[model samples]
Target chain A: MNNSEISEQGKLTIVGTGPGTDQLLAPAAKQALLEADSVIGYKTYVDLIRHILPESCDIQAYGMRQEVERSRAAAALALEGKKVCIVSGGDAGVFSIAGPVLEVISEEDLEKLNLSIIPGITSALSSAALLGAPLIHDFAVISLSDLLTPTELIEKRLSLAAEGDFVVVLYNPASKKRTELIKKCAQIMIEAGRKDTPVGIVRHGFRADQNVTVTTVSEMLNHDIDMNTTVVIGNSRTYRKGRFMVTPRGYAL
Target chain B: MNNSEISEQGKLTIVGTGPGTDQLLAPAAKQALLEADSVIGYKTYVDLIRHILPESCDIQAYGMRQEVERSRAAAALALEGKKVCIVSGGDAGVFSIAGPVLEVISEEDLEKLNLSIIPGITSALSSAALLGAPLIHDFAVISLSDLLTPTELIEKRLSLAAEGDFVVVLYNPASKKRTELIKKCAQIMIEAGRKDTPVGIVRHGFRADQNVTVTTVSEMLNHDIDMNTTVVIGNSRTYRKGRFMVTPRGYAL
Candidate 1:
C-alpha cells in the first residue's frame, strides 16, 4: 500500500451508510471502508454495506442498545494502531456514532489520532427525493426520539417548526408503541398552521417499502405509520401535484 | 447490455459536484457521470469536473443565466435516446439546476422521461462540518438569491427562521452590490432572539481558502460578507467550545 493508505492503516474512518443503500454511500465512505482493517457497526447497518467490505476483513457486531459501548470499543481498538471503521446509518454525524466515538477518543486523551468522517445521505434528504421534493424549500429535520429528551420538548419543537412555516422532516416518527407522539406532532402542527397543509409519508426511505404517500395534515392524523416511515410536513407553499408532494423552495422559475 | 443499463442509456442523471472535491462526491454520482454519453452543465461547473468526463462524452456548454435553456437541451438530448448528465455544485437538488431541469422536463410534457437525482454534500453541511457541528440539531437553509423572486419573500423566510430558533444557514447571502441582505438577516435574527447569538461565517465553504469565523450577532452587524460566504447563525443552544462552533442536537452525556 502507498503512504496515504499506510497512514490510514492505524487510524479510524467513520463511514455513514446513507440510509442503508449501497448506492447512497459516498465515495469517501466506500474508500474508507475499502481501506479498513476491520469494520464495526450495528448489526443492520453492517449488513447494509457488507457487499463492499473486504472479504478478509473482520466484522464486529454490536446488537441493539449497545451503541455507546460499541463506539467506545471502536475507539479503543483504533488506539492500538489498527485501522477501524465505525459505521453508522444515515449521515454518521447526524444522530449517529461519530459524536460518541469522538467523545470517547477525547475522553481517553488520545492526541493526534488521524481520523476522518465519510458523509452519507441522510434518510431525510434521500426520502425527500423519493417523495416529490417536499424539501425543495427551507426545511427543518427534528428527530422525535425523546429517549434523550422529554416529550414536552419534542412537542414544543414541532410547534416551533410549524409556526416558522418550515417544511419539517420527522425522523423516528413512530415505533411499536410510539404512535401517540406523531399524532401529537400533527396536532401541534395543525394548531400552529393551516390543517390542509401537505404531509408526506416516506416508508423505508430509499430501501424496500419506499412507499411515498403525500397527504394532508388531517389525512396524516388519521393513520398509523411504522418506525420505517419518515413524516414530512410541508410549509405554507406546499401543494399536491397528482400523487407527487412538492414544497416550493422559494425559487421562482 | 443489461436491460437497466440499456434503459439508463436514454435517461438523465443529474450528479452533484459536492462542494468541489472529488473526495466529497458520492460514488453513485461519479458512477452516473462516468456512464453518461453526454454531459451538460455551466462552463465553470464543466471545468471543475472535466477530469472525470468520459472520452466518448459530448459536452454541451451553456454559459451563466442560460440554465432553463440548458436544462431543456439536456432533457431533449435524453428524449432523443442519449444519456444526459446535468451537473451542479454541492447537491444538485439543493439550490441548484436539478429542480429547474425537472421543472422544464415536466412542464414541457416530457412525462415518459426517467430522471435520477443523486444527492451530494451541500455547502451548508460542509461548512457546518468544518467547524465543530452547528447542525447537530434541526436547522433552516435559506438562499437570499432574489434573481427571480422579490427580496420581500426572502426576508419573510428569514424572519420566520429567526422566530423558529432553528440554526440558520444563509446561502447567496450577498453579491457585489447586494451586500445588505446578510445585514438584514442578522437584524431579523437579532430582533427575534438575543443579540449575542453566535454566528459562524464560512467563506468558500469546503474550498481551500475556507475561512471560518465565529462572532456574536452584534459583532457581525458591523462586518461585511459576500455571496460566497455561508453564514451560520446559531440558536439559543449554540455555544463555542474552543475554536469550534457547536449546537447541541439534544441533551448530551
Candidate 2:
C-alpha cells in the first residue's frame, strides 16, 4: 500500500491529451502514452492522438457511453500486471475517464493498483484561450448533460452562478437528442439579470473546423452550437474588445 | 484589423506554464517560448521555465504584484515588431497574466498586435489529479485572495457553491498577511451544510516538494496551507477512498 509497493505492481494511468491537438498535449501526457504498454479510450479521442501513440502498444477502442465496460477492462488489465492507460480528450479529472477508472477499482484493490492521473488543458481553458480570456475572474464549470445529473440541479446551479456573478463555462451544450437544456440554461441566465452579459462560444476548439464567436447572452441562440461546443457566459465586467472577448482582472489601469 | 493584416505584425502570446514543472507544460507553450523574441513575466513564473527558454529571447522579470506595469512593457515590445511572450504560472487565463495583458492592448493597437493565448493545465486540474478525481462533476473555482476582488463577493461564491453541492476549488487559499479569508471560506462552507464534506489539499502541486492530503471540511483548518496550496472541497457525494479522494459521476454500477 506504500509508494514503493505500488511501484512494484502494475500501474494504471489516466492521461488527458488536451483538445485533440498534438501541440496542446502536455509533455507528461505524451510521456505516459509513449511509455504505455496498452492504451484504451473512446474511438474519437483515441483517433485524436493516433499519430503520437507508440506502435508497439496495444490499442482498444470503445463505443461512446460504454465507460463502465471500458473502465472494468482497463482495470482488469492492470490487475494482471500490464501497464494500462486510459486516455481522455481533455483533462482526465474534468468530466473524463478519471472518475470512471477510479470508480471501477474496488475498495480492496485500491491499494493494489498503482494509479496515476495526469492533467491536461481542458476544453474550458482552450475555449477561453481562443476567445481571449473570458475566465480571468471567478468561474463555474457546469455540464448540461442530464443523463448523469438532474436538470433541476443544473438550473439551480446556473441561477446561483449568475447571482454570484461568476463567469460560467458549459460543457455538452447541445446534441441531436438534447437541445432543450441549453435553451433552458440561456433562459435562466437571462432571467437572472445577465441578459447583456458577453458570451463566447468555441466549437471544435483547437481543431480544424474550429468556430469562435462573441455574442451577448440574449443572442447566443443564433450561433451554431452542437455537442462539440463550449459556451462561456461572461461575468458582469466581461466585454468585447475588437475581435477578442475580455474580462478584466480589476486593475486600476 | 483584419486577420491577414494582424498576422503581418508583431504578435504577443500569453503562455501558461502549468504548475512550475517542465513535464506539465504544454507543447504549444514551450513552442511559443522557443520562438519568442522576448519573454516577460513575474520572477517566480519566469524562473519556472527559464531553462526551457531559448538563449536568444530577451528576458524581462518583474516584481510581484506588478501586473499592470509588466503587461504594458510586454505590449510595447510586441508593438515594436517583436515576438513577445508573457508567461503565467498556471493557465494564463485563470486568474493570471492573460487579463492584464489583454487589458493593456488598446483597440487602436489591437489590430497592430497579433495576440495568441495558449492554454496550460491550471493548478486546480493539477491539484485534482494529485488527490484523485475530486472535480469529475460540476464545480466552481474561486480565489481566496481579496486584493483584487472584495471579501464579500468571495464569501457569496463560497456559499453559493456549497448550496448547489458543486465541488469548489480554492486558489491562493492562505498567505502570511491574508490568512483570515481562507478560514472564513471554510466557515462559510460548513455553515452551508458542508460540515463533514471531503476536502483535498495539494500544495506545491507537480513539484519536488508536493504534498497531498484528504480531510474533511470541518478539519481542513488543522492542516498547513499557504499561497502555494490549492484546496479542493468535495461535493455531497465525494468521499475518501484510502489515500485518494474521489467524487463519483453518478454512474450506475
The number of clashing residue pairs in each candidate reads 0, 0
- By lDDT, the best candidate is 2
* Model 1 pairs whose backbones collide: none
Q: In order, what is each prediction's RMSD in angstroms? A: 3.8, 2.4
lDDT of 1 by residue, B102-165 (tens): 5666634445566777777777767766655576666778877777657886787777666667
lDDT tens digits, residue span B1-253, model 2: 7997655578889999898998988888898999999999999889989998888879999999999999999999889888999999989999989998889889989887778899998999999999899999999999998998989999889888888989999988999999998888888888888889899989889999999989999999999999889999999899888888889998997
C-alpha lDDT (0 to 100) for residue A6 of candidate 1? 66
Worst lDDT window (10 residues) for model 1 chain B? B103-112
lDDT, candidate 1, at A33: 88
Q: In terms of TM-score, which candidate is strongest?
A: 2
lDDT of 2 by residue, A61-120 (tens): 889999989899999988888888899899989988899888888888878888889998
Q: lDDT for model 2, please.
A: 0.90
The positional error of residue A134 in candidate 2, measured at the CA in angstroms, is: 0.6
| CA shift of B238, model 2, Å | 0.3
